[model samples]
Target: MMNIQKWLKHLSFASMAGMFLILVMGALVTKTESGRGCGDDWPLCNGKFVPAYTIESFIEYSHRFVVGVVGLILLATTIMVFLYSKRKDAKWYVGGAMLFTVLQAILGAMAVVWPQSSAVLALHFGFSLLSFAFTLLLYLVYTRFGGAMNKGDGTRLTSGVRWAVWGVLIYSYVVVYLGAFVRHTEAVGGCIGWPLCNGQVIPEMAGGTAIVFIHRVAAALLGLSILTLFLFIRAQASRDSAVYQAALYSLILVTLQILSGGFVTLAIGYDIYLLASLLHAMLVSFLFGVLCYLGIASVQTAERSSAKAYAASRLP
Candidate 1:
């Protein structure tokens, strides 16, 4: 039984890593305009199991292959949780991963079989983000498993803290979707500079520039919201140390995310192209995962807290 539990932990971590790869590869495919590398082919590269390879085709096909493998591992991990654990939170994390993994695949297929609008394409990345977030949360469960998992932590979160955490998490997702829209619509270059569109605080709110401006504004607001959440967590007198620690990390990650955005802009401005885009995506991914952890941690209720405490007193 112990061995089986250990194996499950390994699987969860592998699945989490796979999900991160999928996100980065998907982003790279878009960054390099490699989505059509397979020429609208689905499940097969250019309608053949092995097709002529171009740089684009190779990158796109590789992403598809990785996604296929990652999907299997994620599915297996989800099933293992159901079979071996009675934890409702574990099941939810696994279930959410399974559902979104399928949705992400379907969206990818749609884009390949038939071209989608920018809005639809943007949603593809959003689904991928959600699938990745849930898988990471599953890994978090095993990593933090102990007294906290067995009996709810004694700390009780207030209604306000719950609202703030949920609000930040949801708003971050919205900002991420807007960023995806900017990428899919080729609006990234519309701003031409960081913190300012061209030489102005606000550029002409028309055409692609308008979309980029909106994403920037939304991202700024998201950073502020996260900062508010961090402050809220710190103010809790008897808060679980986990929540305080996660909040501190959240504050740092958001700052890095915003800074990475600026780096992306600088790269574009100087034509000194690099993986700044990938770095930006990575920061957001970590930020989202941390947010999910806090959201789960916040739900540790006090109703059962006293019960657990009383039960502990009876323990020999």
Candidate 2:
């Protein structure tokens, strides 16, 4: 029989991986414009239990099928975490993962049944991102509680680095949402040229082009912020290698994200662009998870420092 710890470990990993794949498949559904493949009938394809085997129906149904399976995995993970992890933080993180997963699933279903505005539909993707990030963190917290990974040195983050990590994280979400909005609104082709829209930095600020241009600008600022975060973490590399490595990983993801964005532009509306777009989604998701982990580490360090100072004060 598998030990409970081992069972939970495998479950957590499976849940996280499943969520990540769901994220990518969701992107595929959007890029392929297969949302309506089931023809306004959800949980069933066109009023039938089985889909008719058309390309659109197959993509859409496959996505739904995957979501159903992942949902079960998430349910199991949540139950196991509460059963095994008595830590307050562990419970909260796992609970949040379960909550957002359900919320995202509901939002996706609503859009399928009732055509929503672009803004509302865009939010559906945002929730998917949140669900995935939280689930990944759930796995991390689970591992830490089990004493599986090496606990990093007790190094407190300077206020500057701590704030930088958080700032970049929240800003990344805004940039991600903007990108989703571009896709939902069919504004991806608004900027015809790579980097610059229509060979102009400012492309008249009219129609879908304006939306695309603004997302590009926001993304540029996001890149700069992550670079600043990386520098701050690197400045204290000797103190805590763990935080530094997390920052380095964030840097790599953001760089790949930017490159993928450019490729997405060039390959817009083509089957090849689908791969680039999926990469873009996955990079941002993992980047957000890393930033969250760094933030949590900083808090843990601060708490430890406070305890040490209190003990020393009492020593006198």
Candidate 3:
């Protein structure tokens, strides 16, 4: 049983890492404009299992290959999680990962089969990000709880803090979507400056400029919201609590994300922009995953408190 548990832990960690790799590779494909490199082919590159050599085709096909391989790993991990995990929430994490993985794949196939609008393309990235988050949540749960039904630390956060954390989580996703929209719409060049959009407090809300500016504003708000959440959680939770740590990581990632955005802006015309953009995507993906874990931890803490209260009331 101990061996099995160790194996499951390793597998889950691998799946989580693979999922993040897919996110980064997907961003790479988009940044390089290699989505159609296979000439509208799916499951095959230009009617061949092995695509001809070209930088664009190689990148697009490589992304597809990693997706297929990691997808199978995810399937195996999901099955093992359900079979071994004694907790309901553990199963839910794996199940959510499976669901989002399939959804993202379907959306990805559709994009390849037919040219999609920028909005639809952005949804593809959103789905992938969610799938990554679910996988990460699954891994974190397994490592923390060992797939057992252990009661969590009964540290109850204030209702206000709970709501604030959840609210920030939801808003962060909106900011993520807006960022994807800016990328898909090729609006990165519209902003033209860091900390300012087109050299003004407000740029003309026309064309790509508007899209980029809106995303900038949303991202800024997300940073402020995360900072507030970290402070609130710190006030409520101990240094060792899972939610406290998750909130800390989220705050750190958002700060780096903002700085990475500036790096991307400065690298706009340089070869390094591609790397900068991928780093930006990677930070946002991890930030979302940490936020999801924080939400789960908060709920567990609340449940533990509720259970304690009920038991106290029943004491004779």
The top-ranked prediction according to TM-score is: 3
lDDT comparison, 1 vs 2, better candidate:
1
Question: Which portions of model 2 miss their true places by more than 4 Å?
Answer: 142-152
* Candidate 1: clashing pairs of residues: none
Report, for every candidate in turn, its global Cα lDDT versus the true structure: 0.84, 0.81, 0.86
lDDT of 2 by residue, 1-316 (tens): 2587677778878988988988899988998899999998877899998978898999999999999999899888888888876556657777887888889889988998998999998888888888787777777765642221224456666777777777778888899899999989999889997877899978899999899999989988888888987887777755335677677888888888888889989987677888888888888788877877776766665566678889999995
Give the candidates in order of TM-score, highest first.
Answer: 3, 2, 1
Mark the 10 consecutive residues where model 3 has the least summed lDDT.
145-154
Error of 3 at 82 (Å): 1.9
lDDT of 1 by residue, 119-209 (tens): 9999988888898888887877777633343354555667788778888988899999998998899888888888888879979999888
Every candidate's CA RMSD = 3.2, 2.3, 1.6
Per-residue error for 292 in candidate 2, Å, reads 1.8
Per-candidate clashes come to 0, 0, 0
